[model samples]
Every structure is written in structure tokens, then in C-alpha cells.
Target: MWRSKARQWLLRIPTPKCSPLQYQVPPGTLIASRMPSNRPLPTFTCLQNPRLLSASPSFNSRDLDDSDVGIVGNAVNADDSRESEASPVNLDGEMDESGSFGEKGQVLQEFGDSSLGFDDDKVMSEAADVDSLSSLWEESVSADDSSGVFGSQEASDGVVDEIHEVDDEQVESVLSLLQSTLVEPLEASLNKMELSLSEDFAVRVIETPSISGENLVGFFKWAWRNCRSVRTARVVELLVLAVSDVPELGKREGYMLWDLVKEIGAEKGIVKTEILNQLISMFWKMGKAKAGLEVFDKFADFGCVPNSDSYYYTIEALGKRSMFDTAWTVCEKMISSGRLPDREKIGRIIAFFCKGKKGKEAHSMYSAAKEKEICPQRSWLDSLVCSLTKNDETVSLAFELLDDYAKGSLKYANKSFADVVKGLCRIGDVKEAKKLVLRMVESGPPPGNAVFNFVITALSKGGEMEDAIALMKVMEGRGLRPDVYTYTVVMSGYAKGGMMDEACKIFSEARKRHSKLSPATYHVLTRGYCKMEEFEKATDCLKEMKKDGVQPNTDEYNKMIQSLCLKALDWRTAEQLLEETKESGVPLKGITRSLIAAVKELEVEIQSAENNIEA
Candidate 1:
């Protein structure tokens, strides 16, 4: 190891004899010979054999090359000498005129009367072993790469490294200031750090941990003001993220930070779409929907074209506050621009419009996103369809959406299709309602009892008994039992037709299937029998309802009593029903009770008139 290090050390030294010999170096004479530079400079010293300098003046300069000279790597300025030492060059050992060297000092003593000097302690220790000297040499160079104080190249490198360390420390200082300084007037704090600002420095400060968004905003404004170059595109983006990243940032603070971003963008002309988008997203997270909208509106001012995220976040913000009108407007813009957010975000937009009852606009967004191949998830589509089916005008749109999403088992679609069927039925589009039921039965998501009941009820109300029965059969074929409401609808249709037999057939089937039927079935028959003036059958229905454990509603009693009073004028039986109705705790209508009283009075008047005539 010692041999290898000694060789490496020997190779590092250059000229030894020509070294400007200084017997005594001043306090800092070894600092630098020339301006510090990066070029590899060989160090020179006169510490080697001092006897080499004793060559006579008559010796040719070329002869000095043949003579032995030691190696030291550096150039020493000859003119920098302070004290000259006695000549240590021994001519007998060196050379004379024949074997002589002229210009023994070469360039070092080029001007006449210049002296070579060596004064350092290391020189006097020339008698020291190569190993000891080698150790000392290593200690000095290893101690500091630039400590070869007379070596300008190493000094230059040292200066560069020092500069980098200082820069790093200043950046840390700025970051410390950023985290602690919350209020305004950040420039003073930054100035105290004496930061040598750069994009990297600004980025480091912005990225510092535990830094509040407010402090970051302050720091950002400072950077923009004091060092505009630090606000590069990357720096600005990081600034936005740093400002937006704080979870506790309130709406007011969020707006202030956003305003700072805007001001910087406006003046610096460095506004970017993503930068603005970060602010919008921050507002969205903060629930500051209005502020997000303002940022969205100024997209043009920032020289940024709104992207898909821009629209999505803006719509989401507005929707958060139930600002559907403005949200829809932005959604329309997104549609017109043909830029839709990702599938998930598109789903959220649909939900927003749905929440606002803007089902039509929601559908439009859904369709446009579909056109762009950005369809929302199935659940979202289902929600959109549900919303569409709510309004009479948009039921078909919901119906259309149903077909697109009806791909899988259609089981998930059952709820949505149920709503669509209801809307279809409510709008009196009984034909379409029937088709939807059949479609469900044939394709997928076989209609449940509710969907079937809706269509059946609509058909029965339209007096289409056959269609209503047909739907009930289809429903049974699918193994879904018709609820009591379903059977009631079929019977009502038949009773309306005065086909008592058919109505009774449906009633019996409902009784067998349901163990207990709704009172609506009995009412249907009572109405039908009364229409035929067969009060006996109507009274039997009342008896059957009581036997069957289905409580009769007031409507049946009202109709039966009115039939006896008005149609049959048989107020005697009607009075019995009134007493029965009263005993049963059912409140009879005032008009029906009055009719019975009127009938009683008429009977008395008739008797008196007849008696008077006979007398």
C-alpha cells in the first residue's frame, strides 16, 4: 500500500527545480498563484534536493534537463518571493560548462538577480523517509481537495462545492421560513434567508413538508415578485399543488390562494391549464363551488383552454352546492366541446344533474359521453335512467337508456325499468307500457310484480280487460305471482264491462291464490252487481268480504247505500246498511245519510196524500 501510494504521489508532482523558491512563505503566500481555475495544474516546490540548484551559470539550459530534478506538481510565481535563501545547488554534483546547464532556474530565474527560496517546514524535513513524507502529503490533500492552496485548479473546485452547499442551506432556510411564516409580508422573511433564488430552490420550498397552503401561497407570491425566473412552468405547477394540498384550508383561504395564483398568472403570462385545474379541484374539495366556477370562467383569461377535468371539477363544484342551472350550462359546454371527463367523472356529472332534477340535461351529458366512448358505469347509467323516467316528457329517453344498459342479467335494470314502466303507464302510453313488460319477460330482468301491475292497472283503467288479463298471464308464466293489487285490476276491468261472470272468475282465482284478497276485488263485483240492479249479489259480496277477512273500505259502502237510495229507492235496506256501516266504525258520507232520510219523508208524504184523497 505504501509503495502504490508513493508512486501515485510521485506521479502527481511536476517540476521541482524551477519552483520559485521562497525560504519563508508569508502568512498566506501559499494561497493562489493565479486566479482559481479548473484546469489540472501541476504543483511545484523547491523542497526537493536543494543541491540541484548549485549548477554554474555557464551550464546550458538544455543540460539541466539531463540532470536529475525532483518532482512537485504546481507552478510557483517567481516574482512572489519575499526572502531569498543561500544557494543549495552543488556544482560538483550537478554539472559545469562542458557538462553544464545554463539557465539553471529556467523560467523561474529568467530575469537576472531573481532568487529561488524554500522556507516551509516540509522542505527542511527533506531528510524524512519517503513513507513519512508521503503520509504528510496524503493528509494535506485528503484534508481538503483544494487545500493545495497554491494550486488554482483545486481552489476553483473548492469554491464551486462551497457555492453548492451554501445554495442548499439557503433553500432549507427558505423552506423553514415558508412553514412557519403564515401571514403576509413574506418577502421580508425570504430576504432574511438571503436566498439565491432558482427554480429548484422555489420548488424545494414549495414541496417542503408540513407547509400550510397559506404559507406556500405567500412563498409563491414572493418568488414571483423577487425572482420571476423561479416561476417556471414546473415551478408554477408545484406551487398550485402545494397551495391546494392542505386539507384544513378553508373556503376563504382557498379563494385567497386561488386569487394569488390568478394574479401571478395574469401578470407573468405563465398560466397553464393544469395549474388552474389544480385550483378548481382544490375548491371542489373545499366545497367552494363558486370559487371554482370563477376559475373556470377565467380559463380564457389565463390563456388556458378548458380540458375534460376542467369541466368535470367545475360541474362537480356547482353540483355540490345544488347549483344545477350553472352546472348544466358548463355541462353543455363540455358536450359542445366534445371533451368528456373520464368514465368515473362522467358518472359523477350524471349524478349531479340527476340530483338537480335536470334529467334531460343529464341524459344529454350521458349520450355525449357515450358518443365519445366514455360511457359511465352501469350503476350510474341506471341512476340516469331512473331520473329520466321520472318526468313525463323524458320517459322515452329513460327507456332508451334502459336498452343500452340492459346487457347483463337485466336484474339490476329491474328497478330502473320499473320506474320507466310506471312513467310510461302514467303518461297513458299503455301500448308502450305493455311492450316494455313483454320485452322484459322475453329478454332479461323479467318484470317484477310491480312493473306488471303498473301496466295491468293502466290497461284496466283504459277498459282493456283482455290486455290486462294477457299481462297477468305473462306475469304468471314468468313465475312472479300477482299480488292482490294485480288481481284487483283484472276484476275492475271486467266489472267495468258489466261482465259479472268474468269478474267473479277473477275474484275466485285471486281468493284461491291469495288466501285473502284486497277489498277492491269485492268492490268491483259490488259495483258490477249494482249496475245490474242485483243488490242481493252486492250484499253477498259484503258478506264474503267480511268472511274472507278483507276489511271493506268506505267506498264499497258508499256505492251500495247510494244504489239503494238513488237507483232502487229502497231506502229501507240502505238504512240497514247505514246502521251496519255505523256499527262497523266506518264513517258514511253525509249525502248518502240524507238520501235515506229524504226517502223516509217521501214515504210519509205519499201515505198522507193518499189518505187525504180517500177521505
Candidate 2:
């Protein structure tokens, strides 16, 4: 009877709405439960003991008074509602409010507080403790976010700063150690430290302010001795730049670094062509052209063959320092290697030779280069021929070189031939220049009239009036009309040679042909009169210049003043001419200013003499 009564009581119990179980059940397992209404019991598969579920005694308890039970039931309902609102449970029950099983247990424990046998006061105290623990957890998380592995944000930054300070201190330590130890004898220091000088160590040496060049040299020597190698390019280039930044060491004195660098490089058996070339250029920029050449010469010893650029820089540096012989040797080497210097470098070398009046050597180098099938470029040849022609000793040879080259190489024949004529004319070899001009006409189309004008001018200047006129006739026959430059050249040439009549005739011809004389044409006539001390005639020419709407430029005025002071001995007229020049807004030439001073000095001397006589 008691069992039947218990069964009835159990049957009357409504199905409780509980939280989803955390554990999973096997497939095909059945669960049975009854509803509150008069409905049949529902069967659930894959669930065990659906009628009576096991609950943890620590979370749920059966010991409760009726009043406490009522309160606990309401509290459990409220807690369930709060959990449901906090995290929605999936209907399929595949996941719970807490996806993790451990978190789900904590959730269950918190909700299980309602089933505890404690009174309302004990439950309230536990709730307050739980809230305090949650707040502490959040604050700990916040602290972790700000501090990372360190204690606080500032402490984290302080850690990073400490790391940087450690690195800086390491650098300072290394530098200080090197400064003290490197001052000792190199062998003794090496023996004591047994140092391994790496690129960083070399960089430290280069950047250290207390490091002297001698100390640097010793360090590198020691490094090379121990390691059998050195940082030839990287360390050396940095050292060079550093030394160059120092004004005292930047000049030729800085080249001492090269000696050390070379020693190190040679010891290491490292001879790179590009590095050597750069070293040469570095020396040149530092005003050590000779040192650059020295580096160039040693390139072969290091097994690096000098390229055309290498040879060009060496020759240029040598030439710039007026070391012509060495420059010529380097050029010869360049040519022997079947290479030619670049045009700009060639011009520099040629100018160097011209300044020294060693034009024959320059021409010889050109000829040798051509013989070796390494002809200079046309622009370089033009500069060379121009330089050679300016020298009296090499003008004929320069023309011969052009004439010979013209026979085989017609590409530059016309231009080369023209250079020859112009060069010969510049050297007052109009006779040769005319012959070369005819040769050029035969070889190619007629040369420009400017070529004939150069020869005519040269002949007239040489007092060969007949040759000058003949060349002019030849120019006209070739359908080349003489321009203002031509007339000016011929007239100035005749005037310089004191043949005023021929100059006048050339002027008349210019007017007849062109129908107008340029300002330069008038200046030529004025200069001619000045050279002959014909002051009145020169003055008339100036007046005609103004009447013809051409002003006498500074050169024309300077020429007249110089003649009046030097030849005419008429300081008064020179003074008046200078005053007019100033009024005309022309800047006085240096020579003109000196002439005024001379006139003032002469006047002071005359005044002193008259005073002495009066006394």
C-alpha cells in the first residue's frame, strides 16, 4: 500500500523545466517524462533517466522547510531567467549557455545556489562574495591588457627603454674598450684581447671620434694580420668619407688613408676594379690627384685590369696636377689596351698639353691611338686639333695628321680637314691652311666660307696680302659668300699687320658684297687706326659708328684709350674718352682703369717736379 502511495505521489509530480545537461548520451537511448496536464509521457531518444535526473548535492539539496523551499523555487526560477537572458541556449541543445563544459559547470553551480540548504542570509552573503570575485577577475584582465607582461604600461615602456639603454651602453663599452686597448702596441693588444674584428667593429672604429687615423691604421693592420683579410670596400669607403668630412684631413693629407687602405687591401688579396676606380675618384675630389694615379697604377698588381674609365680618371688627375709625363703614360696604356679616353677627358689632357706647349706629344698620342685602331672620338679629335693648332711647333703636324686621317676615314674627313685649316690659320700658317682647304674641297663638298676666311685672315695678318686676296677669290668661286665675321677677320688681320690700305679695301669689299658693315666691322677699322696711331681717323670712325646707329663697345673704347696713352702719349684725350665711356654706361675694363691711374700718377709726378723748381 505504501509503494502504491509513493508511485502515485511520483506520478503527480509535474515535469520540471531544468537546464540542459552538459554531458551527451548515446544514440537510440530512450528517456521518459510526464507533463503537468493529462498528456501521455514523452519518450526522448539518446537520453538516459529522463524521469529523474542526477543533480550535484553541492549545488542542489532536498533538505528545506516549506517556506524555504518556496523561496528557493522562486529564486531558482529567477536565476534561470537571468542565465537565459545572459546567454541564449540553443533549442537543439547541441551547445549550452557556456560552450565549454567547465564554464557550463560554473554556470550550473551558480544557479544551483537556489537548491542549497542555507537560509536567505547565507545565500545573500555567497552572492556578494561571487560578485566581488567577478569584479576582481575583470580588474585583473584590465591590468593585463595595459601592462602586457610587465606590471603597468609605464613599466612596459621602461623595460623597452632599458633594452635600448643596454644597447647604447654596449656600444659605448665597445668603443671605450677599443680606445684604451687599441692605443697599446698592436701585437700586444691582439695578444691580450685575441680580438675578432668584424664589420661592426670596423664601423665602430670608423665612427669613434677619439680614434685617430694612425690608430685606425694600426687596428686594420692588426685585423689583417689576424684574419688574413679586411673590409676593403665597405670599411674603407666609410673611413674615406669620414676623413673627408674633416677639413684638416680632407686635403692631400687625407691620402695617407689610402696607404693604409691599400696595405690592407693588398694583404687581403682583394683588388676590385670598381672599388679601385672609386678610390681614385675619392682621392681626386679630396685634392689628391697624384694619389689617385697611384691607386690606378696598383690596380694591376691587385689583379684588377683597369678599364677605360679607370685609365681616363688617372690620366685626367695626373694632367690636372700638371703631371704630363705620367698622364701620357696612362693614356698610352689606355690606347695599348685598345681603348680611348672619353671626350671630356681627352679635351682635358689636350688642354694640359697645350698649356705646357707640348702639342707634339698630344698629337703623337692621337696618332698612336689611331694607329692602334683606337681613334679618338670626333669631338675629342676636334678639341685635340684645335689645341695642337694653337701651338706653333705642332701646327704643321696637326694638319698632316688630319690630311692622313682624311685619306682613309672619310666620316670625320671634312670636319677634321676644316679643323686643320683653322688650326693652321691660327698659327699664321695660311700658306699651309690654303693648301689644306683645297685638299678638303677635292675630298668632299666645298668647305664652309669660314674656313677660307680663317686662311685669308691669317695671310693678311702675316702681311701676305696677295695670298689673302687669292683665298678670298677662291672662296667666292666656290659660291661661298663672305659674311660679316669674314670681313671683320680680314680687316682686323690687315690692320694688325699695319697694312691700312688692304684693310680699307677689305672693308669696301664687305660693303659691296653685304651692303652693310656690322658694329664689329666698324670696331675693326677703329682698332686699325688706333694701331697705326691715327687718332683723328679712329675718332672719325667712332663718330661714324654712332651715325650708323652702332655704338663703340667697351673693347673699341679700351683699344682707343690704350693707343692714346701708350703710343700717342696723350693722357688728356684718353681721360676724355674714359669720361665719355662712363657717360655711355659702359663698364670700364681693368686695363682702362689701370690706364687712368697711370695718368693720375704721371700728373702727380709732374706737379711734384714743378713744385721743386719753384722752390
Candidate 3:
């Protein structure tokens, strides 16, 4: 009856299925039968059939854990050797039909005695080992279940990296939504886009067409309230661009804006160099260049270091608007700070210095640049050389710099030689220029056609047409062909000398060589005819300009209308020209002013003649 009960338990249990790594046991089933080391194995003295001790069908390597097998291997039976061997169960909890009970008892006894040693110390050590292994297996299974629910660690990280990358199109779309002028709509658009902007980029995007000053200030306050980090430079720049056009951004407004920016900068501990430079750029763009200079002066009080770009832009802005004295002060400041302006900026500085008639100071700057191994641009060097040659005292020094430059860098020899010729001719010293030309020709490398054109232009302006015409012939004798600039210069010279026929001949020659002539070339001929009071020829010039697809600018139209007005032509013709000027989208202010003044003067003369006749 005991054998039947054990056999029935084994049959009732389900079979274990094989998996990739191990066999799986049924849920809620105890995979191993535990018998404590302190307790003895159960004795079945009445059970005679050894097959009843066979393992359940559900029992497999995975169903019985390693610890259960270890305990079974340590179990010893005290039955007779033949009877123990006849038992079917093996130490691995598997049924072994070939082993008799006697052999099983012998194997079990040997396993328990030799391997387990069955002492208290040995059992305790084995128990600790089993506990550690069990904990490790549980942890591994928990990790696998988590991974199955989600994904592998590497795959999840890749998805997160992709989500963080910024898209330019998305940024533009967000900016587009903020085009509404109303605060409520703007807030709604921002929420709809679900976007956040860095405060600097946000300020840049405030240039939407419908955004007003009030809207901007509200948005700024909102950003501040929300603790957004805005760049001081970008905020100042945006305010200057957007608000300066509305009304005078008065001292009170400027102070408020600056205080806000400064307070933020102080809180963040940011470097204020860039912010100050931006303020200067803003003032210059708004035509408040003197104010920009004052802003630069405040840099020291704010503990900001003004960089080379700061001084460079200030000087350039002042110089462009003819504020030379202030520009010089800023340049001096830059030099004192021991920071050299970059190559492009240095060109502007040298040009400004030359404009102030301080050729010596400009040359000194160029020398310093050279000493520092900063190569000046070809255009800047040419301008400096020309300016130096214009003055009697610096001409020799200019040549010395050029000679030194030529020795060090051989690439600019032709350009240097041409500029020198042009400068000497400009100053009405063609005799020295002629000598230089002869030397350039006799030498292995000849001067360009630009030098010959410069000489011809000088002679024609000085009333030496015969000499000018002779030089043009000699220029063609050389292998070099004249470019459009060469032709334009000669035409300008002839026109200025009242030699319209000669000027037209040069214009036709240029047209023959190159099918297209510049608008400047056409203007030269028109002005020459106008000066000669040949209205028909001048009118023909305008028609030709139109046929050539060259739209005359405001100045060109002014010249033509002035000629017509001075000739006392019909007001109807002037009216027609005014209409054309309007249709062409050129500004009508100057043209209309000239026409109105000319008509009023003609009316006054007509009334005076009528009064004389009546008397």
C-alpha cells in the first residue's frame, strides 16, 4: 500500500518541458523534496518493490535544483547492501532501473561518507553555499524578467539619444507660431507647439512681423518670471532693432533695459565683454555712434574686458560717418590693450586713418602688423601706399615699406607698382610717373594696362589730350589688352576735357571689344553730351541705356533731369520723366525738388517780361 501511494504521487505530477538553458518545472510545485541533515531518511520496511521509489514523471534535471541533488547525494541508507541497491532512486533524483537496492545503498553510503562527510561543520558550510547560489539564481531571473517587459539596456539608450537631437525645421515651426501680436494667442501658440527655447535663441526669434513692443516686454517678463536664462547681449540687440524704430529709446528706457541685463549677468556671474560689444553694435546701427562710444567707456566700471572686435567696430562706425577724432581715440585704446585687430578689421582701421589725413599713423600701424607677422590684405596695402604717396613727406617712407614688402613677399609686386603709378598721376606728377613707367617696361616684367590708363587719365585732365591719345596707342602696342575699367577711365578723361567725339570713339572701341559696357560708361557719354548742351545726343544715350537693360539709378536720373531743366525744356517732358522715375521705384524727392525749383524760376522770368511789356 505504501509503494502504491508513492507510485500514485509520481504519476499525478506533470512532465517538465525542455527550454534553451534548462528544464522548466510546473508552477506552485516543489521541485525538490527536502530532508534535513539532522533528520534520517524515511524507512519503508514493508515496501518490497524497488520500482515504487522511481522519480515522478515530472522530475527532470531542472525540476530538481542542484542543492536538492547535493542533499540527495549526501543521504545514506542503513538497510542491507543488496536491499539498498535494489531501490530505484539515484542521488540526482532520477530513477535508475539497472541499479539493485544493494548497489544503490553502497553508492549512497560512499557518496555521503566521502563527499558530504555528514558532520555538523560540513553540513553548515554546504548550507551556506546553497543559500548563496540560490540568491544569485533569483537575482539573474529577476533581471531577465525586467528586460523582457521593456527592452535591452543598449537599445533603450539608443532611443533616448535620438529623442534629444534638435531639429531645425521644428525650431522654425515653433518660431512661426509666435507671429501673433496678442499675448494670449502667443501663449496659446507656445503651448500648442510644446517647445522650449534657450533665451538667446528666443530673443533672436522675436523678429516676427506682428510682434509689438508691448508684446515683447510682456514675453520678456514672462520668461524672467519663469526663470529662463537669457543672454544679455541678445536681449540688448533685439531691443535696439525692434524698439529704436518706434520712438526715441530714451535714457530712462535704456537704463531700465541695461539694469535688467546687468542684474541677470551679475546673478549668473557671466563675462560681460560680449554684452558690452553688442550694445556698441546696437547704438551704431541705430545711428547713435557717439552713444556707442559712451557705452564703451563704461566697460571699465563694469569690470568687463573689451576685446579687439569691440574697439575695431567702434572705430569703423565712427570713421564711416566721418567722426575721425572719436575713431582715433578708440583705436588708441585698442593699441593700449595689446590686442591686434584681425586682418579684415585692420584694413578698415588703416582706411579710416588715411581718411583722417594721418598717413604716418596709418603706416606705423601697418608696420606693427608686419612685425607681428600678420599679413595685410592687398587692398589695404594698396590704400596705404596710395595715401602715403599723396603727401610730400611720406612718399619716400611709402616706397621703403613697399620695397621691404616686395622683398619679403613677391606676389604683390605688380599691384604695388600699379598703385604707385596711379597715386603719382592722381597728384599731377605725371613726369615722375612716366619715368616709373619706362623703368617698368624696360625691366623683364612690364606694368599692367591699369598703369597706362592712369597716366592717360591724368594727362587728359591736365589738358594734355595729344599726350593722352599717344599713350593709349602705346598701351595697345604691348601684348596686354585693356579691360572695361581701362576703357572707362579713358572715356571719363576725354569727356571731362570737352572732347565728346574722342570720348564716343573710346566708348565704341570698348563696345567692339566687349559686347557689354557698364552703366558708368553710358553715364560718361550722357554727361559729356549734356555738358555740350546737345540734348538730342543726351536723350539718345538714355534710350541706349534702356535698350541695354541697364536701369539708371537716382543720381543718373537727377543728372538727366538737371540737364533738361537747365535747358528750359517743356514741363511736360519733365513730368513724363518723373512718372518714369516713379514707375522704376527710384526715389522721386530729389528729382521733383529740382523740377519744382526750375519751374518756379522760369515762371518768375516770364512774369517779369510780361510786366516789362505792359509798361
Candidate 4:
């Protein structure tokens, strides 16, 4: 059976043997087989069946001739006996495998142990087994090739699983090793790979989320450092992906990328618009606005004329932060570059001025826009009108300009009409304001709530309380709900006319309606109470002012104190109020001193009258 096992092992090898004389055992065979002891063999009864033995060439060595049987049997017994004496081993490379004498022998030799005896039969048997194993391996490899088995199919299927198992350990080791010795060479290799695969693979690789952004950036920097044009585009693509993934990295390394782009421009003659945009956006997002602008300037030097969207992004960033001056400068640069600013950018500029209450500049910009044939859109006109109304002088000019422009053949005339009417009423132009409103209602859509509110405010301020009320009724009749401004204006009108009951009624109505009450509304009410000589009511309003988180200005405080003094005819309280004002950090200006002097004069006249009456 043992001889048969040897023969079977040999027959499984597909390669034809050279003449028997040419067969030689490898050098380690002899040392591997020799041992001092032996053990019982595994059961060979399974191989006792003749039919089974005959069916398997690997198990049929008993059918060989006597000489062949003798040689095969001796080799088999020798290898088995030697293997039986070998010690068992563990998986950590610290021990030899059981029944494998070669590994033990090598270990023992290294430890200076040569007392073990050698066995020639064991050596020959081991040599024959090794030959058979090599022949079987070669045959299996060829068969796999002929059968069209892919080399890495199995590896590919298990790659993720394998990576999960090994990544933690291998990543650190591999990265450290790569860093220590292979960095430059690996960088060069990656650069070459980038150049070769740019056209074919860049898009796919860049869009992959699993790719390491740091690695991608490193490779890009390497490629840029080497002045490799062939890889520049691919490197750029990877850099874009890196920036998209890790925006903070771009901010930290923006200057380096900028320098790289400049180098690319000098070496490859390729202008990198995408890189410039990425750098700008990154710096802006990181709150480095100045750096963002610097990169934008570089884009121009690279002959990259930024598109409208780019300008819009930069301008909007500045405008949102109330940096109107910067935004205007950027706008000028954009226009000077022959790029027309869009409506959104223009709207932002208008909003910035409105927020800052720079009415004159806003109006100037609007006029400039019109002169450039840039038809201001509805939103731009709305903001412009609001801004103009903040200052009286500009408001009148703005209304006239809008009226004139609307009369012309300009396309935006209809929108301009609404804007002018709103501006006119905003600045208290009652007659012309009513005319514009009538024109709008007769020829166009009926007056909007904003238009009605403005007209009511103008009429109320002009003391046309009846007309203002009529307009409010008209608005309600037209199913237009009056807003807080309408109620506030009417209440102010009643208060100015000393109609305390009417003013209180309007205030109660406003509160019940839940209409908005702004600081100006409160100011109007406070002044009204003072005019009525209702000091307690006025003080109550001031307390409400505090509760509402409104900081009363020096004017409001001064008016309140003056009204209190006048009502009580108390000179001492008035003087104390002036001292309190100084303590509250309100500087005593020339007007305040004059009022104090006038109060002292009244006190002198009162004292002289009292003295004469007593005499």
C-alpha cells in the first residue's frame, strides 16, 4: 500500500520524466528526512480494496515490478518514519510542523545540534514526493490557464473583505515604509500614472468617494513639482476632487495650489480656471476674503476671464457681509473686464446701500445702471425706492427721474411707475403721490398694499385725517388688509391733532389686530402723550419702550424731561433731569444748554413775582 501511494503520487504529475538517470533530489531532501524515532502509520485499510487502488493511479503502486516496488517502498517508508518523529508546530513561525523533519533539522542545525542520524531511504522518499508535488503544481497551473481562469478574479472578489481585515495593520506599516524610502520614487511613478491615465481615468477616479484626498493632493503636488504637463490635467482633476472633499485643506494649502497654478501657466501654457475658482471658493468659505481676492486676481493674469457666475459668487459674498465697498470695487473690475453684471449682483448692490442708508449712492448707481441700458428689474427698483426715501432730497429727485423714465420708451417703465409712486408718498408728496396712485389704479393694477400704505402715511402727515381714513376704507373695500404702517400713520395723525381718544382707539385697534409696531410708531405715541401733558402716560410708554428692548435716543429722553418740567412748572426736577442725562452719557450739547438757561430765566421771573405778591 505504501509503495502504491508513492506510485500514485508520481502518476498524478502530468509532465513526462526525463531518463531516470537525469532525476536528482533537491539539496534539502536528505536533511529533512533523517530522524531518531518512528511512530505507527495511519490506517491503510481504505486502500486495501483492489478495485479502489486500481481506479486511482495515486494508490496503485503495488502493481509495479519488483525492482520498482523495492525502490518506491523504501522511499515511502523512509519519508513516513522521519515525518513521524518530527515535532508539531504553531502558526506564528516559532515551531516546526509535525512529521516535517526538514524544518526541525534546519532549526537544530542553527542551534548547533548535529547528533541526529541521517537516513538515505527517508531522503530519497522526500525527494520523490517533492518532485511529484512540483509536477502536480505545474500541471494544475497549466490546466487553470487552458480553462480560462482569470489570475485575479478571486482576489478581486475578496478585495474589500481582505482590505477590511488588513487595512488597519497594513496602512500604517505601508504608509510609514513608503514615507521612509519610496516617497520620491512612488511620487514619480504616480505622476507617470496620472499622465498615462488622465484622459481615460481621471473623471472616474476623481468622483470616487473612497479615494484619499490627502493622497490625491500629495500626488498632485508631486506632479506639479516635476513640471509634468502630461499629468497636469489629471493632477488638476484630482486636486478638484480633493478640494470638494476637504474644503479646509484647500484653505490651508491654497497658497501652494496658487503657486502651482502659476507654475503650470508658465510651463504648460494651460490656464486653470477650475483651480482658480476652487481656490477662490475655498478661501471665501474659510473667511479669508482677502486671499480669495488674491486668487481671483491671479485668474486674470492667467488670461482667464471669469464668467458671470464667478463674479456673482464673489460679489454676493461681500454683499452678504455688508462689505459694499469691496463689492463695488469687484463690480467695477468685472465691468472693466467687459463682463456685464447680472441683475442679482445689481440687486445686492442696491440692498447694501439701503441697509447702510446711503441713499445718494444707491440712486446714483441706479441712474448709472439706466444710462448703461441696464434696465433695472422690479426687485432692484423696489430696493432703490426704499433707499431713496430714507433721504428727502434724493426721494424727490428719484420720483422725478422715475416718472420721466417711465414716460420714455424704456421697457421697464411700468415697473418704474410703481417705484416712483411709492417714493413720492414715502417723502410726504401728497398731491403728486395721489395723482400717481390714481394713474396706477386707472390704467394698471389697482394700488397694492405698499402703495396704499405710503399714500395714507403722506395724507396723515399732511393732516388730511379724513382722506387718510377714506383711503383706508377703500383699501379694505378692495379686500386689501391694512398693515401696521397704515394704522401707525393714522394714529400719529390723530395724536398730532390732539385727538387723544381717537389715537388711543387706533392704538387699541392696532394691538388687537396684531399689526407690527416699529420704533417710529412708539416714538410717535410717546411724543403724543407728552403733548397731552400726560406725564404718567408718557412714562408708561417709556417703560414699554424698555420692555421692548428699544434704546431711547437722547432726543426722546430730552423731549420727555422737557415736557415733564413744563407740565409741573418745577425747575429743580428739570435741572435734575439734565444732570441725569449727563450721567447717562448723553453729552450736553449747545441746544440743551440753551434750554437750561431759558428754564433759569423763568425761575427768576417766578421768584420776583412771589416777592412782589408777599410785599
Best by TM-score: 1
Q: Model 1, range 389-454, lDDT digits (tens) per residue?
A: 888899988887776774753777789888989999999998998988888888868778898899
In model 3, which regions exceed 4 Å deviation?
A: 1-210, 221-271, 404-615
Residue 498 shift from truth in candidate 3, angstroms:
34
Candidate 4 local Cα displacement, residue 338, angstroms: 3.9
Error of 2 at 185 (Å): 11
- Model 2 TM-score? 0.43
Write down the RMSD of candidate 4 (Cα, Å): 21.6
The clash count for each model shown is 24, 0, 12, 3
Of 1 and 4, the candidate ahead on lDDT is: 1
Q: Report every candidate's CA lDDT.
A: 0.71, 0.61, 0.62, 0.57
Model 2, position 115, has a per-residue lDDT of 36
Q: Tens-digit lDDT track for model 4 on 241-260?
A: 46555634644455555566
Model with the higher TM-score, candidate 1 or 2 = 1
Q: What is the lDDT of candidate 4?
A: 0.57
User: For every candidate structure, what is the RMSD over all alpha carbons to the true structure, in angstroms?
Assistant: 15.0, 24.9, 21.2, 21.6
Tens digits of per-residue lDDT, candidate 2, 375-447, equal 4665555556666767677677766656444344565556656767787766666677788778767776368
Give the per-residue lDDT digits (tens) of candidate 3, residues 329-444: 77777777777788987887898798788788788778767877887776766778778877877776665655554444444567767767777776677887877776677752
